[model samples]
Target: MSRDRQRLLDYLVHILEAIARIERYVDDLDEVGFLTDELTQDAVIRNLEIIGEASNNIDKYYPEFSAQHDHVPFASAYEMRNALAHGYFRVDLEVVWKTLEKDLPELGLSVDKLIRQLMDENSGL
Candidate 1:
């Protein structure tokens, strides 16, 4: 594989790892527990930041790939990262909880699929 493809694969792997970490961090926590546990909240938010950073890198370095895979919310993830990184006080835990509950699983699936597709394409090449 070319260096660019390898880098992109690294980013995808980082995203998947972050997602898994977030899942494990919140595995047993309800909304209330998540909100109340500052450590877990911090861990989750940090992983989210990682996801957004990886997404941003993918968009920057692999614009064509990002454009083609419009199903992945690369822009949105980066935007959310900006919000969390810049304005921690304004973060609404309720929304975070909702995102965790609803959006993350789907995001994980999409990213996993992308990783597999990328690997398969590389193998063919």
Candidate 2:
């Protein structure tokens, strides 16, 4: 595999790992208010940022990869990451919670699929 592709793959792996960690914390939440916990909030936002960065890098090498995956919200996800990373003081926890609940799992699945596709393609080559 090309170095670029390898780097993308590494980023994707990091994203997946971060997502798993965030999910572990989130899964323990019994009520909506649980999102108010500072640790949980921090972890979720950080993982989302990682996911976005990885997705963005992957898209850079394979623009069609984002469109092809269909499971991940590549552009919007990255935008959210930028907002969280750059505008943390102004970011709304409610929005972050909603995003975690609604979008994260889908994004994780999409990234996994993309990673597999890259692996398969590399093997074939």
Judging by lDDT against the true structure, name the best candidate.
1
Instruction: For candidate 2, write residues 23-103 as lDDT tens digits.
Output: 898887844655568877887788888878876776677687556765567778788889999995898888787777787
lDDT scores of the candidates, listed in order:
0.93, 0.78
Tens digits of per-residue lDDT, candidate 1, 1-125, equal 78989999999999999999999999999999999999998898899999999999999999999999999999899998998899869988888889899989999999999999989999995
* Per-residue lDDT value at 58 in model 1: 95
What candidate 1 gets wrong by more than 4 Å, as runs, is: none
Clashes per model (N, Cα, C within 3 A): 0, 0
Q: lDDT for model 2, on a 0 to 1 scale?
A: 0.78
C-alpha TM-scores of all predictions? 0.96, 0.82
User: For every candidate structure, what is the RMSD over all alpha carbons to the true structure, in angstroms?
Assistant: 1.1, 2.2
lDDT assessment of candidate 1: 0.93
Q: Which one wins on TM-score?
A: 1
lDDT of model 2 at position 125: 50
